[model samples]
Target: MRLKDPMKRLNAGLLIIAFVLSLFAGRLVQLQGIDSGKYEALAMDQRLRRIELPAVRGTITDASGRPLALTQEARGVFADPSLIDPAKRTEVAARLSSMLGLDVQKVLEAISTPDSRYVVLAHSVTPEKGRLVLSLGYRGIGVVPESRRSYPSDAVAANVVGFVNQAGDGGAGLEYAQNKLLKGVPGWQRVEISAGDGQHIPMGEGQTQEPVPGQGLRLHLDQDIQWEAQTALADAVKEFKAESGTVVVMTPDGRVLAMASVPTFDPNEYAKADSSELQNRVVQEAFEPGSTGKVITAGALLEEGLVTPESTFDVPDHLWKYDKKFKDSHEHETYKNITFGGILAKSSNVGTIMASENLPDDKLYNYLTAFGFGAETGVGLPGETRGLLHPPSTWSGTDRYPISFGQTVSVNSLQMASVYATIANGGVRVTPTLVAGTLDEDGAFTAAPAPASRRVISEATSHQLIRMLEGAVGREGTAPAAQIPGYRVAGKTGTAERYVEKAGGYKGYTASFAGMAPADDPQLVVQVVLQDPKKKYYGGDTAAPVFQKVMSFALKSRKVPPTGTVAPTLKMFAD
Candidate 1:
C-alpha cells in the first residue's frame, strides 16, 4: 500500500512537469513561426537608424596655396530643460552665461520652458569652452560639433573670395561664383539614439559616417602682390582724402594679379559692413575713363598705320569749337608743334582730337571694340558691367572728339586695365580671369579651363605703341612719377571730370594711372583710379605715384629680373 502511494505521487509530479513543458513548447512555436521576423526587423531598424551630418564647406586659397577663407570645428551647446535640476539650474545657468557672454536671464528662460525638450544655449562655442562645459557632466548640457567658416587671411581678398552664410550658402566673390564646387555632398552618421528621449544610446554600439568636406578653390590672385597692392592703394586713398579708389594689377597674359577696392570690408565680418562697402566697384561701376581712353585712340591710330610715333600734328595749346572747348592739361609758353609721342606724353586732348579727326567713325568703333570695349571682358566676375561706349549710330554731334580723349565714354577700371594688358601682351587679347582652379573633396585640383583669347592687332602695332608709351613716362611726359629706376616703364595718366547725376553735368574729377612696366619685355600692367581726390586733382600727382610703388612691389614679387637700366631718367626716347 505504501509503495503504491509513492508511485502515485511521483506520477502526479511528472504529470505536472509534463503539462508545464507542453505549455512552454506551444508558446515558443507560436512566437518562432509567426512573430519572429517582425521582432528581428524591429531590432535591426533600431541598430541601423541613420541621420544626415552636414559636411564642412571648402577652403579658398590663393594661387600660392595660402588660405583666404576656410572652415573649422565649432561646438554647439544645448540644454534639455526638463533634466535641469531645480536647485542647480540657477547656478548652472549663471556659470554658462558668464562663460558664453550671454545674459543669465536668457539662459534661465531657455531652461524654464516645460514643453521644450531641448534649447540652444549657444550657437557656436570655442573648443576650450566646449571642453569645460562637457567636463561639468550635468544632466542637461550637451555639445555637438559644428562647422564654422573662418577667414584666416582676414580680408586680404575679401571681395574676391566673398563669404558663406549661416546655412552654408556662398554670398559673393568666389564663394558665390563657385558655390557648387565649394559645397560638397553631406554624409550620414548612424547614431544609436534612445527611444525615450533621443539621447545618445549609452549602452549600445554607435555608428559614424565620415563627413565629406567641401572642395577647395584656387584663385588667380597672388597673396603677396595682393597684400602690397591693397596696402598701397589704401594708403593712397587715405593720404589723398579721396572719396574712393581702385587698384588692379594683371599679367600681360591676362592673369589678374590683384584687384582691390576701398573702403573695403572683411569677408569674415561682412554681416556688419554696409551694403555699399560690399560692392566691387572696379567691376560693378563704370565711370568716364578720361584720358585713359587716349591709349585706345593712340593704339587704334598706330594699328591702322594712320599715325606713327613720329607723326606730327599741328596742335595748339587750346582748341575751341562746340559747347565744349578743350586744351592740354598744362599750358606751354610756345605754340609747339608736337609729335604723336608728345601728344600722348602730355595727355593732350586737343592733340588726340586732331589725330582722330581724319579717321572714320567705323574704324574708331571697330578699334575700341577690338580692344575689348563696348563689350564685356568675359572676366566672369559677378556684377561686371560692360562699359558705356556709344557706337557710330549712338554718338551725338561733337562726341567723336571728346570720346577720342577718353571723354563722353564710360568704362570700369578693370576694363581699362585689360586694354593695357592686351597692348602689353603683344596685342593678344586674353580674357581676364580670377579663379585658378577648382578642387574635389579629396583635395585634387581640377584646373580651371584656359581663358579664351584673340589676336586683336599685329605684334608690330603693339611694339610701336610700347615705344610711344616709353616717351609718355619720360621726364617730359605727364607721368614722371611712374618711372622705375631699373626697368622700362610705359603708362598713361587719366584725369576726367566726373559726370554729376544731380546737376546733369561733370563735376568732380577722377584721377587715374594705367601702365605697364619693363616695356622692352612687358610683365606687369597696373591700373589705379582715385575718385575725387580732395587736394590733388591731377593723375600724375595723385595716381601715378601709387602705380609706381605698387608696380615696384609687383615686379620684385614676381621675380621678374630687372631689365637694362631705366633711361637715366624717364624721358621720351626721341628715336
Candidate 2:
C-alpha cells in the first residue's frame, strides 16, 4: 500500500511513537511481575520496625515473706548517631552527660561515628533521667524501659542474694544459681514508624506480644535468725581481730536458718567492692576441725562396741603412738585415767586417741563420710566446696591418731554445723536447702521438695553422743561459756593450730564451737568459727561466746521454750 507523500510522512511518525509505548509496557510488566515481592519487602524494612520488650526479673524473699532481692523499674537511653545533627552534637552530648552521669567527651565521640544506627548511651537509667532526656526532643535519642536490681536486706545475706549487672544478668550466689528460673521470657512487637517522625504507629495498626514475668524465690532462711547471726558474727570477727569468721545456723531438719560470713559487702555497691569481700566463707573456707572431731571419734567408738560411755582408759597427758606425740590442750597430772564420756567433755586428745585405739582408720573414714564430710552439702547455693576428707589410703602411720582428734581432717563451717545437725536429727543426715519453694508466675506459692534425709547413725548411738555432748558444755567441760541460761546446751570446741602455706608449719589457730540447743531435744544447730583470734585462740573462749549469743537470740526470737532439764554432770573419770 503506497501512500501519498504527506500521508506517508505522518504514518512513519505515528509508527515510531507506537513502538516506544509498547517497549514501556513490556518493561513495566517485567518489573512488577518479577520483582514485586522484593520491592514490597524493601519498603516494609524502611518503615516497619520490630522492638523487644524486656521481661521483669523474679523477686527473692525469705521464708517469712521478707523481700531480699527485687527488681526496680528503670529506663535505658540509646542514640542513632546517623540521625544526630552534627551542628548540635556538642549541645546534645553535654545535656546527656549532665543528666545521665555520663562523660561528655565519650558521648560526643560515640555520636560522631559515621553511619552508626544504634549506640547505647546509658543502661539502668533512672526514670527521672529518661524523662529529662525525652523532654529534649532530639530525633536521634530514644528511651527504652529497663530494670535495676536491688537488695533490700543490704549486706545481711549479701553473699547469698548476690547482685545483678547493669544488663540484668545474675553474677553470684542464689541469683546466679536460679538465673534460669528468675529470668522470664521477653516479648516483641512489630510496628510501623512514620516517615516524617520516628514515632511508632498506634497498636491497632501493629502486632504486639506480652512478656512473661519471672518466678519468685522463697528461701528457707529465717529473717530474725539471720539478722541475729549477722550482727553476732560481725561483732565477734571485729572483737577477736580475726582474719575472717563464719556462722551457720540450721534447724534439726537441715533447713538453713542463717548463713553468715564476715568481710561482706553491700550488693548495692558491688561494683566498688573487692572480690574477696564477696566470698561466702561458710561454704568456701576449709580448716582443721581440731578437737571437735573427738565427738566423731567418740561416737564411732561407742557405735562399734569399742568403748562405752562408762569405759575407762588410762589416758596420759602425752600420747605417743604410731611414731607421733600428741598432747592435750593443757597438761594436768590428774587427767591420767579418763572415761569415754569424760574424754569428750574435757576435749582430751589423748583420751580420745586411747578410746579409738581399737578402731581402724578405714572404719573412722567411713563414719566421717556418713557424717556428711568429703562432699558438697548440695544446698544448691553457688560456689560451694566439697571440702577435703582424706581416704584411709592417704593416711600415714601417724595420721590415725591425729585424724581421730580432727588434726588431719579439713572441713568448712557448714560441714561442721551439719555434723552437729546429724546428731540433733537423731542420727539422720538431712540435705540442707536454701530454697523452701518458688512462687509461680500466677503468684501461687508452690512448695519445693522436702529436703532429703538418710540415717547416718542409729537412734541409740545418737542419744549416747547427745548425752556425751551435754557434758562438754557443762561447767566441768571445755566450753563452759557455751552454756545458755535455762537451756541444756551441748556442743564441741575446736582449737586447731592453723597451717601456714609457705612455711609449712603451724602458725595461727582456728577456734570454733558447734552445738545444738535444748540438748535433750535439740532444735537448732549453730556453729561459730573464728580464724586466728589473737587474744584468745581457744574455741572455748572465742567461738563458744559467739555460739551463745547467736543461739540465745535465735531461741528468744523463735520463741523456743527452754528445756527445763538440767544439764547432766558427766563423769570426768571412771575407775
Candidate 3:
C-alpha cells in the first residue's frame, strides 16, 4: 500500500511541475510578442528626457554699429522633483540656496511639491555659476542653455531702445513695437537618460532640432549724439527744477539723430523704474506749442498772399477777443506799425492774431493739418499721441482766434519739430524715422523704406518763413540765447500755460525752443521742451540755452560748415 501511495505522490508532483512550466512559457510569449510594443513604450517614456534649446536673441545697435541692447549667453537651472529623495530634499535645498542665492524655504517647497515631475530653480544664471552648480553632482539637478538681455549703453537711449522682461519678451518702446522681428523661434532636443540617477546616459540615443536666431535692429540713433543729448537734458531738468524734459535732434529729412527724455531708466534694471520714467515723452505728451506754432500762421498768411516779411500791422499792448485778452510776454506801449517779421521776432501774441484775422478759418485749419498737426508723425515709436485739434466744425465761438495764435490747439514735440523741419527741407514734411534698417542672422542690412514726404507750402514761402524765423533769433528776438556762435541759427520760443491733470486746470508753463542751425542752409533740427519749470518759465530764459548747447554739439559733430552769411536786417517798427 505504501509503495502504491508513493507512486501516486510522484505522478501528482510531475503533473504540478508540468502545469507551472506551461504558465511560464505562455507569459514569456505575451511579453516578447503580443504586448512587446506597449511595454517597450512605457519603458522608453520613463527613460527619455527632453531638454529645451533656447534660441539666441538679436542685438539692437546704434547708427555707428555700437551695441545698445543685446543678448548674452546664460543658463537655466532645473530639477526633477520626482527623482529627488524625500528625506534629502531639505539638505539639497539648503545647498542650492547658498550657491544660487535663493531662499531655502522656496527651494524646499519647489523640490517637495506633491506630484511635480519637474521645476525651474533659476533662470539667467551666469555660465560660471551654472558650471559650479553642475559640479555639485546632485541627483535630479540639471542646467539648460538660456539667454539674458543686456543694455551696454544703459540709460543713454533706454527710453528709445526699450527693454525685455524676464520671460524674454519685449516690454516697451521699440522692443515692444518690433518684438516679433526681434524674438526668434526656440527648439528642443530629446535624449535617453539613466532612470536610477536622472542623468544623461552617455552614448544613448538622441535627437536634436537646431534653433534659428533672431534678427537684429540697426537704429538711426547716433550713440555719441544720444549720450550728449541725454546728459544735457538731465542736467537741464535738474537745473530748472522742472517736472520733466525732452530733447529731439533730427536731420532736415527726418532722420532722428538723438531722442532723449529726462528721468529715464536703464533697461538693465527696468523693474525698479517708476512708470512715469519709462515713457518716451517726446512723442507721447502733447502741449499747446505756444509761439513756436506761430510759424504755421506765418506760413498760412504768406501762402495766401495776405502778408509778407515786410508787411506791417497796428501793434497794441493787448487785444481783447470774445472771452480772452491776449498780450505779449511783456507789457509795453503800443507801437504804431510793427512789421510782420517783427511780430514773430518779438513773439507778440496779439500781433500774430491780428495778422491772421483776414484768413478764413478753413484755410487756417487746412494749413495746420498740412503742417503735420493733429496726426501721428509715423516716427515708428509706440504710445504716440495724435494731439488735440478741433476741426473748423468743432471749433467754439472763440476757438478760431486762439487757434490762430497757437492757443487752444495741441501738438507733440515731434510734430512741432517736424513743422520747422518742413520749412528746413524746402517746404516738404518728411515722416520722421528712428529705425534705419534691420539686420538678418547673416548680418546683412536691408535699409528701411525712404521716409514719406509731401510739400506743405511753396519753396518761396518756406524761404520767407525761414527769414522770419531767423529774426526770432536776432538780438531783439525772444530766443536770442538760442544763437550758436559761428553758425547762422534760426529758431522760435514757446511758453504755454500747461494744463495739469492732478490740479485739473492750467497751473504752470511749458517752456520750449525749436530751432535749426546754419539757417541759410539748414542741416539739423533740435527741439527742447521743459515742463512746468520754476523761477524762469519763459522759453527764451529756460529752454533756449539748452537749445544752444545741444545744437552746437550736433552741428559741430555733423561737420556742417557755416554759410558765414550775415542775416538780413528786418524793420521792426515802421518809421
What lDDT would each prediction earn against the true structure?
0.82, 0.85, 0.89
Kindly list the per-residue Cα lDDT of model 3 for residues 1-575, writing each as its tens digit. 36568889899889999999999989988998899999988888777777777677788999989999888988888888888988899899999999988999999999888876568898888899999988988888877778888998889899999999977788999988888889888788887767766667768877889888888999989888888988888888888899999999999899999999988999988989999999999999998899899999999999999998888888888988877777778998886788999999999888888898899999999999999999999997889999989889988777887788788889988998899889999899999999999998888999999989999999999888888888899999998899888888889999999987789989899999999988889999999999999978999989999999998998888788889899888678778
> In model 1, which regions exceed 4 Å deviation?
1-52, 78-124, 133-141, 190-199, 202-211, 331-335, 500-505, 565-575
Model 3, residue 506: C-alpha shift (Å): 0.8
After TM-score superposition, the amount by which residue 189's alpha carbon in candidate 3 deviates from its true location, in angstroms, is: 2.7
Taking all chains together, the TM-score of candidate 3 against the true structure is 0.94
Per-model TM-score versus the true fold:
0.84, 0.90, 0.94
Candidate 1 lDDT by residue in tens digits, 1-575:
35568889899889999999999998888778788888866775654445456677888888888888887888777776766788888998898898888899999888787866557777546778889887877777777677778998786878777888766778887788778767777777665544444355656565677776778888889998888888998999899989889999999888998999888798777888887778788888788888888888888888788888777767777887677788877776433556887888878888898888778888888988888887877877778889788889977778888888888888888889999999999999999988888777677888988999999888898887777788778877888899888889999899999986768987789999999989989999999999988889899999999999999999999898878764433233333
Better candidate number, 2 or 3, judged by TM-score: 3
The predicted structure with the larger TM-score, 1 or 2, is 2
- Give the Å error, residue 313, model 1: 1.6
| Model 2 TM-score, all chains together | 0.90
After superposition, the stretches of candidate 2 with alpha carbons farther than 4 Å from their true spots are 1-40, 47-49, 103-109, 191-206, 500-506
Pick the TM-score winner. 3
- As for lDDT, the candidate ahead, 2 or 3, is 3
Kindly list the per-residue Cα lDDT of model 2 for residues 1-575, writing each as its tens digit.
75679888898989999999999988787778778788877877766666666678889999888999988888878776767778999999999998988899999998788866557788888798889888899877877777878888899899878888766778888888898789888787776655543544565246769888889999989877888888998898888888889999999889998999888999988988888888888887888999887778877888889888988777778867756688988988756557888888888888877788789888999999988888998788788878778899988788888889998678888888988899998989998888999997666899998878899888899899999898988878889899888998989999999976667888899999999988889999999999888977899999999999999998898889986777667887865
Clashes of each: 3, 0, 0
